[model samples]
Structure formats: C-alpha cells, structure tokens
Target: MNLIKQYVKEYKNTYIQSVLLAVLGVVSGLAAYIVLAKMIVGLIGKNTEFGFYLQYGLMVLAAMVLKEIFAAASTSISHQATFYSLKKIRQEISKKLFRMPLGNVMNISSGKLKNIIVDQVDSMETILAHIIPEMTANIIGPILLLIYMFILDWRLAIVSLIPLVIGMFCMKSVMASYGKKYQQSVEINQKMNNAVVEYIGGIEVIKMFNQSETSYQKYSEAVHENAAFYYHWMKETMIGVSAYRKISPMSLLTILPLGVYFYLNGSLTIVTFITIIVLSFGTVENILTATNYMDDLSRIGTITKEIGLILDAPDLEHGKENVSLSGSDIELKNVDFSYSEDKKVLEGVSLTIGENQVTAFVGPSGGGKSTITKLIAGFWNADAGEVIIGGKNIKEIPLEQLSETISYVSQDNYLFDMSVRENIRIGKPSASDKEVEEMAKLSGCDEFIRGLSAGYDTIVGEGGGHLSGGEKQRISIARAMLKNAPIVILDEATSYMDT
Candidate 1:
C-alpha cells in the first residue's frame, strides 16, 4: 500500500481529481435512484400530479447522463495518470539496472526480470486506472446512501446491514491465506515463464543435439505444475468465494421481510418503507461491486514488493572524480578477486603494460586472462588492491571517464535489431554516414556488407543473427575502432575471424 501510495503521490493532483469525479458520478447515480423511488411512490399513492411525475422522470434521465459523463471523465484521467506512472517506473528500472552491479543483475534470470519489468508492471494498470477510483466511489457511495436510509428509518437501516456482515465474514475466509496463495501462484508462473524462455533460447542447441524430447519434457512439467497449483488453490477457496458472491447481492432478503413487517404493524409509513427498501438495495449493490475488486487489491502488495526489489538493488561503487590521463599505461598491483565466495580467480597478481605496446596473456582457459582484462576496463572491481591507469586507481575514476578511455569488446558482442549503419554508429553516436563507412572498410567488413541487398543500410537481425559469425565479428571490431578510445581490451575478439 505504501508503494502504491508513493506512485499515486507522483500524480497527486490528477489522482485527486479522478477520485473527486468518481465520487460525483456515484452521487449522480444515487440521485437517479432516489428520483426513481419517489416516482414509484407517487404512482402508488395516487395523489401526485402528472407534471410532478414527468418532472421526476426527466430529472432521473438528467442524473443518469451526469453519472455517465462524470464516470467517463474519471476513467480518462485515471488511465492517463496510470500509464504515465508506469512509464516512469520502467524508465527508473532501466536506469537502475545500469547502475547495479552486473553480477547482481545477472543473478536474476532474464525471464524473471522480464516478468517484473513488463508483465508485473503492466498488471498494475487496471488497479490504478479503474479499481482505485471506481472502487473508492462504489464503497463510499454506498456508505453515503446507507446514511440516508438510516435517516428515513434507523431500524430498517440496521436490518439492511445483516447480509453485508454475513458476506464479509465469508470473504474473510477467502482472504485468510490469500497473500500466501497468490505468492505461490506467482512463483509457479515465473518458473513456467523461465522454462519457456530458456527452451526457446536454446531451441537450436536442442535441435542440434536431438535433445528436444528431454527439453520439452522439462517445459511441460513446469506448465503442469503451474496449472496444478492454480487448480488446487482455486478449489480450496471456491467455497468461501461462492458464499460471498451468493450472499452479498441478496440485500432484498432481509429488507423485504423486515420492511413488510414494520409497515403492517403500523410502525412504518408506506412512502418511507419503499424509499428505504430501494435505497438500501442500491447501497448493497454498490458494496458488492466494490467487493468484486478485492482480489486485485490483495495482489497489490506482492506486485509492488517485486518491483521494489529491482529498484532497490545494490549498485556498484562509482566515484565522481574525473582524472586527466597522460598515457594509456595499465597496472595491476596485488589484485585478488573471485566470482563467488569459494572460487578465487586471481590472487596477489601484479603486472604492468607500458603505453604504445601490445601485451598478450597466453594461458589455458579459465586462467583469469579475461578476468584480468575485465578488471582493468572496470567491468568488475577487484576484491583487493588496485588496478591503476594513468597513475590513478581505476576505482576513483568516473564511469564516463573510464568508458571514454577504454574500449572493451568481448567475444559475445551483442548487436541490436537495427541497420548495419546504426549498429556501427552505436560506438560513436554522432558519427556521420561517411565515417561509418570508413570504419566498416577499415575493419574489413565493407565488401561483405556491400554484397548484401541493402549494404550498410541492411537491418541486422537480433544479435546479428542474419549475419555470419565472421561478419558479426568484423562489425564488432568496426564499432570498437570507431570508438577510438586510447585503450582497447579484446577478450577473444578474434576467435571467430578468418585470417
């Protein structure tokens, strides 16, 4: 609720306006109910004038129109606020991801992050846009209408509340383990999503190894588990849910019998009795409508908690100081680091490479060669000691300065789904078309790119899927070359390239 309130606070004025309009709409609806009840009474008494009855009918029509207009206005405002808030949240999440440690970000699976950023965030739309304003109106409108009923006849108002209390008692049973149940359901769904994404991502590997059956079996198992969880949860709660649904709307059961008793015994006038009955019916109907949204309301806490986790993820330490570099000399002094607690990759390592010199680290795989380069480029900080460039500890350098000084291209370079020209221009966003072509030719990819149907303008599929491995490598090389940073770290950068 605090999470939701924080977002609502961002668009406070618009949100308040939406709630106010919704209240007005509810008032208009209740006014129409009152006019209709009076018209019914006038017809029954046989002492009302024809013009008076016609005036009441017209007033009812006017009230109905006002209700719709205000309701639409409220919906429109709330939706605008909700969508904007979602956009802001997504942007913040994106920015936060960049600041967070790469290890921390990777700790969460792609499927889970996708669910949080896209699906879970999207689910809040209905609650914010419709449920918040509409449910508030529905609940408050009934309380106000019930107060009017009490003024008409206090005893009948008290009688009208019996069904509501019974319905709430049943609803409490459904709500008892609702949070736990909902959390379990969400976990199962996330696992299913993860399996689906993993299967699709590894489809080529599965097909190549003929492991489709085993892989598909895992996916099927996940789907079945999710389905079974929901099935059992719903089965368990069905009785309580059904009881609430059946009992909440039966307002007239208590009202009809008790109002008749009061009237027959000369304790209640016919006009007042009929008015109480009609108004009480409207009150319970509003409450029932509001009750229908309880499931969505209950899930808000869980959803916001998930989103909060991402927004609050720990970030890597970054400094504000910007240093001027005289040369691209790189040094590592007593650096010790590990990817995990027990597995130390590098320990007490010391090395130095002079400016304008090429150095190679030749060793067997998993021997900290890539790790050494990544530390120097500030991809990850060493656990102890310092990696220095230009005589200053890399930790003290601003991220922007570090990025500008070093161009690190890894083996698995990612390419966006965009034109060949646009992909290369990512290294230097302001590079002109001629400059892009120059870099592509320098990296030896220009001939192949020209052979394609659209040359540099051709759209590279996701991760350069449409291009060959060597072509992708050349494009990556071209992008790095375009960056023109003083220091370049090529970790297995030439593994896919042909001589």
Candidate 2:
C-alpha cells in the first residue's frame, strides 16, 4: 500500500477532491433516509396535509439526484488520476527493464513479465479509482450516521452494532491466510499462462514433429490445475463469505426488535425509534459495500510485491562517463561465466581480436561461441575477469558509449512490426532514405527488398514474420551495418541466409 501511495502521490490533490465528492454523495444518500423518516413520522402523527407530503417527497428525489451527480463526478475524477498513475508505473517499469542486465531480464519468464506489466498493474485500477474514494466514503458515512443514532438513543445505537460485530468475525476468518493463498493463486495462474504461451509459440514445431497431442495435453493439464486450485479455494472460503454477507446487513433484525422493546417500555419516543430504524438501514448498506472490497484490498500486497520485484531489481553496473578509445582491438583476460551455479559455460578463457581483422571462432555446438560475443557486446559482465576494448577495461565505458562502439548480429535477431525503411532506420535513427538504401545494397538486402510489395517501405510484420528466415537475416545484417561501428560481432547471424 505504501508503494502504491508513492506512485499515486503525484495525483494527491485530485484524489482528495474525489474523496470529498464521494463523501458528499454518501451524505446526500443519508439525507434521503432522514427525509423518509420525517415523512413517516408526520403521517403517523395525523398530519395528512398534501402539501407536506409533496414537499418531503420532492426533497427525497432531490437528495437522490444529488447523490448520483456527486458519485458520477467523484468516479470520473478518480479514474483520471488512477489512469495517470498507472501510466507512470508502466513507464518506470520500462525504464527499469532498459537499465537491468540483459541476462537477468531474459532469465525471467515472458508470460510472468506480461502478467505483471499488463494484468497486475491493471488490477490497481479498482483500488485506486473506486476503492480509495468510495471506500473512504462508505466508512466515514457509517461512522457519521452511527454518531447521529447514538445521539437519538444510545441503547438502540449499541444494539444496531450486534450483527456487524458477528459479521466481522466471519470476515476475519476468510482473510486470515488470504495473502499466502493469493500468492499461490498467482503462481498457479502463471503456470497456465506460460503453458499457453509456449504452446502457441511452438505450434509450428508441434505440427512439423506430429507432437500435437503431447503438447496439447501439457497445456490442458496446466489450465485444469489452475481451475482446480480456484475451485477448492472458493469451496473452503464460501461458508465464511456466505455468513458475512448474510449477517452483516441484517442490522434491521437486531434494531427492529430492540427498538420496539424500548418503545413499549416508554424508554424510547416513537419518532426517535422510527428514525433510528431508517438510519440503521443506511448505515448497514454503507458498511456492507465497504466490506465487499476487503478481498481486493487484501490482494494489494501481493500485486505490489510482484511489480516491486522488477522495479527494485539492481541494474547492471557501468561507468557514467564516456571514454576515449585508442583503437578497435578487443581482449578478454581469463574470463569466466555461467548461466547457473551448477554449470560453467566459460572457464579461464582468454582471447584477442586485432583491429581491421575478420575473426572467426570455429567450434562445435554449445561451445560458448555466442556467449563469448555477448560478453564483448556487454550483454553480461564476465564472472571472473576483465573485458577490454581499445586498451581500456569495458567497465570504464558508459553503456551508451559501449553500445555505440559495437555492432552485433545474433542468430535470433528481432525486427519491429513496421516498414522496412523504419526497421533499418533503427540502426541509425537519423539515417536518410538514400543511406538506408545504400546500406541495404551493401548488406545484400537491396535486390529482394526492392522486389517486395512496397519496396523499402514494405511493412515487416511482428518479428519480421512476413519475411522468410533468409530475408529476415539479411535485413538484420543491413540494420547492424548501418550502425557503422568499429566492432562487429556475428554469432550465427547468417545461419538463416542462403548458402
């Protein structure tokens, strides 16, 4: 909740206004109940004047109309503030991703990240836009109404709270281990999400290998496990939930019987007793609405903690200042790295590549060829030793400067869903159309690109899916080539290209 406050603090004034309006709406609703009691008391007292009935009836209508107007305004304002805060949170997460180590970010499941960024952050909308303002009104309104009831008759006021107290016990039981249970729900849901993503992403391979049944079974099992967990969880909590819902709003049960007893004993006046009955109904309605949000409120900790894992992650260390390079030579001194503790991918490895040289690291599959290039490109820091570029340790160079100094093309290069011109221009954002065309020709992408439906302006679908593997590789090459960096590292970059 404190973390969420930090994000929403910028819109504090707007939220305050929303809360104030919501409170006014609650007050108006209470006013309607008071007006109804007054009318009933007048009719019972033998005041059968038509003008009096019409006056109180119009007042009740006006009160209800004002309540709706204030509620609408409050909701509108809160939603605006909430959406702004959500935008800021997402933007911060995006910056956090950029600053984090590539390896660390890649290690996280894509489905989990999507769930946090898209789904989990979206969940905050209810808490911010509706819960905060309206819940505050619900609570404060009941408190204010209770004060009025106590003033009318202290005995009935206390009696009115009996149902509420019992309802609270039921509510407490349901919320006892809510945090732990909600976390388990999140984990189970993530497994289903991951399974669905993997199944769809590998649909092509599944068809090619005739493994649809096996893959589908895995996906189906994950979904069933998630459903089963929720069903059992609801089964366990339903009794407590039902008891709270049934008992909480039954304030009339206690108020009616006790008020009548007091009235029969001449301890309570008829008008006061009747008024207390009407106000009890209003107070109970407000309390029940507020209590209904407890489940959403309880889940806040888990939601924020999930998002916090990404926002609070340590970024990769790099020097802030750019450095002057003596030359383009690269060197690694006794470097080592491993994706996990149990496996050592690179150990005591040393290498040097001279300037203006076409160096090739020839090795069998899984020999750390791609890992070695990634280290030079600053994708991950070497576990044990220093990587040097141009007579300077790579750590001394700022990330921006290091990025500008290297041009890397990997086996699985990604392309945005945009035109060929825009995708190639990403290598050099300010590159003119002619320069892009020239780079395409230099990288051997010109002939095929010109033959496309829209030439260089052709739209490349997501991940360049519209292009063949060979065409995708050539376009990637053109992008890297446009950077015109001193260092170029190609790790199976041409694997998809024609022989």
Candidate 3:
C-alpha cells in the first residue's frame, strides 16, 4: 500500500475528482429509485393524474440516463488513473531493479520479480477501477436506505435487521478463516511462476538429460496447485453468496408481515406497511452486497501488500552527489560483499584491472570471479571499501555515465530476438548499420554472419539459439566493442568455444 501511495501521489487530484463524480452519479441513480417509489405512491393515492405522472416519470428516466453518463465518465477517469499508476509503477520497478545491488537482486527470482512489476500491477486494475467506485456507492446507498427505512417504521426497521447482522457475523467468521489464504495463494503463485520460468530457461538441458517426466511433473504440479486454490476460492465465494442470498430476502419476509400485523392492529397505516414491503429489499440486500464488495476490497488489500513487499524494499542507496570514474583502471580496496548478511561471498578480496586491458579471472568455478566484474559495473555495491576506477570511486559515478565507462560480457551471452546487427546495437543503440557491421567483424562474427542467408539482417531465435557458441560469443564481444568503454570485464568470455 505504501508503494501504491507513493506511486499514485502525483495523480491524487484526478482520482479524488473521479471518486466524487462517482458518488454524485450514484446519488442521482438512487434518487431515481426513491423518486419512482414516491411517484407510484402518488398514483396509488390518486393524487396525480396519469399524464402528469408520465411526464414526471420521463424526466426521472432522463435524469437516470444522465446519472449513468456520469458513471461512465467516472469510469473513464478512473481508468486513466489506474493506467497511469500502472505505467509509473512498472517504470519505477524497472529502474529500481536496475539500480539495486546485483548481489541482493540475485537472491530473489527474476520471474517472481517480473510478475510483481508487470502482472501484479495489471491485476490492481480491479482496485483502482471498479472497487473504489462500487464501494462508495455501496456505503452511501445503504446509509440513505436506512434513513428512509427509519422514517417508515423505526421499530420494524431495527427488528428486521437481525438477519443481516447475523449474516455479517457469519461472514466475518469466514473472512477470518480465509483472510490468510490470500497471502498464501500469492506465495504459491510466485513459486509457480518461478518454476515455469526455470523450466523454460533450462529446457535445453532438460531435453539433453531426457528429463521429460521430471519436467512434466513440475509443470503439472504448479498448474494443479493453482487450479486447486482457485477451486477452493470459488467454493468459498459461492458459499458466501449462497448464505447471503438465503439470509437477506428473508429480511423483507420477516419485516413486512410483522409490520402488516401492526397495521392490522391500528398501530401503522396501510401506506406505511406497503412502503416497508417495497423498500425492505434494498436496505438488506444492498448492504449485504456491499459486504461482498468489502471482501473484494480485502483481497485486493492482500495483493497490494504483497506487491508492497518488493517496491517498498529499501532501494540501493545512492549518494546525492553523482560519482565519476575517470580511468579504466579498476581497484577494489578491502571490499567485502554478500547476498546475505552473514554469508559473505567475497571476503576482503581486493583486485585491480589495468586500464583498457583484458583482466581475465580464472578459477575452477564459484570462486566469486564473476562477482568481481558485477561489482565493477555498479550492478552491486561493496559492503566494505570502495571500487575505484581511473582513481575515482565507481560508487560516486552516475549510473548512466558508468555504462559509458565500463562493459561486462558474461559467459552466457544474451541476444534478443532481433537481427544479427541489432543485437550488437545494445552497446551503442545509436550505432549506424555500418558501425554495427564493423563492430561485428572486429568481434569475429563477420564470417558466420556473411554466410547466413540474411547475413547481418538474419533473425536469431530467442537468446540466439540459432547461433552456435562461438558466434554468440563474438556477437557479445561485438556488443562490448560497440560500447567502446574504457573498462571491459569478461566472465568466461571464451569458455565454451567450439575449438
């Protein structure tokens, strides 16, 4: 909720106006109901002629239509608010993920984080779009209904409300039981999302190892759990609906008869008894339905809180003054780092990369060599000591300028589903077709690219699946070459070549 609050603060005025308009629209709509009832009573009393009534009825109909128009306008306004908030949120999360320390980001699932930033924001459309306006109507409509009910027969109005109160109490009990389910379900969804992403990522390995059965079971289990949760959720929803349906209609049945019995004994009038009968349904059902609306609200609250956990996390702190790294020379002094507080991966290890020269880190595996490169790129911050580059601390450098200063090409070269030339453009997005080709040749991809039917324009499969190890490596190097930064860090850059 704090994340949402911060994200939406800029759009608060527009949101307030939309909600106000919605409230007015709902008021106008409920007015039509109350007016129609009064008009009917006038006819029943023979106080107004049919012609006069018809004219007034038409005016009420027109007003109701206008109310609906206001409602539509309110909806459009709310949609804009929701869409803008979502857009800002996605952008913010993207920036935050980019800015956050790489070591910290690595501890969480990328798929789950992706879901939080993208899918979760989209899901919140329900809260900002429908829930707010409906809740306003529900709360306001009931208060008005109760006020009118009081004017009719205070005693019976109070008496007949027992069923509604009972229904509410029962609902509260059910809510208490299931409230935790919302959070539980969210966790399961994140896990399932992570599994699916992992499955897709390692599909090549799975096939190579003949692990079809194992892969299938993983996929099936995630799907099955999601389905089971939904099934139970739907069952619970039905029970709530059924319980209300069973309980609320009886408010009228209970109230009207008792009111009539009073009228028959001369304590009430026929008109008052009739009014109670006609008006009883909305009083009970509207509020009862309002309770359903609350349940939706509670569920949305859960989602917002889940989303909050990520967006509200302490951002990778940056000094107010921008830091600059002047030379390609790299130095880590007494730099200690860890993903967790106690489990340090690089413990007081210091290293240096001489300017404009390749500094290869060789170790069997898991020796924290790649971690060193990540730290150089400001993808992460050292828990202790500074990462000095060109005699300037890298931490003081502005992120955009840092990219202009350093490039890291990891072993697993990543390529977009784009033309051979386009993949190299990431190093310098504005590079011309000629510059891209030149860089590709320099990185040793020119031969393979020229042999392709489409050459530089050939579309690689996702992650460059169409390209072999050496080709992918060259393209990655081409990207680095295009970057032309003063510092280049490579992690297993030539590890899996076909040689």
If scored against the real structure, what TM-score would every candidate get? 0.95, 0.94, 0.90
Best by lDDT: 2
Clashes of 1: 0
Tens-place lDDT digits, model 2, residues 1-499: 7768896687889999999999999999999999999999998899979999999999999999999999999999999999989998999999888778888899779889988999889999999998989999999999999999999999899989899999989879889988889999988888899999999989989999999999999999999999999999999999998998899888889988888888899998999988998999999999998888888899999999999989999877778898999999999999999998999999999989999999999898999999999889988888899899999898888889999999989899789999999999999999999999999999999999999999999999988989999999998899999999999989898799976
Candidate 3 Cα lDDT to native: 0.77
Give per-residue CA lDDT, model 3, range 1-499, as digits (tens): 6655664577788777777777777667666666676676677788757777887698779768977888888899888888988888778777776777765577778667876776778878877776666567667876887788788789887867878876776566567756588777777888789889889988989999999789979988998998899888878767765776577667876786788789889998767766666666656655665576665666766767757666666655454465644557888899998867778888888877777666667786877888888888888888898888878777667777777777888888889999988889999999999999998888778888999989999998898989888889889999999999877777788876667
Segments of candidate 1 deviating more than 4 angstroms: 47-50, 321-323
Instruction: Give the per-residue lDDT digits (tens) of candidate 1, residues 355-439.
Output: 8779999999999999999889887888998999988888788878888998888888788999999999989999999999999
Error of 3 at 409 (Å): 0.7
Candidate 2 lDDT at 358 equals 94
**RMSD values, in order shown:** 1.8, 2.0, 2.8
Model 1 Cα shift for residue 7 (angstroms): 2.3
Q: Which ten residues in a row have the lowest lDDT in candidate 2?
A: 1-10
Clashing residue pairs in all predictions, respectively, total 0, 0, 3
Candidates sorted on TM-score, descending: 1, 2, 3
Quantify how close model 2 is to the true structure by its C-alpha RMSD in Å. 2.0
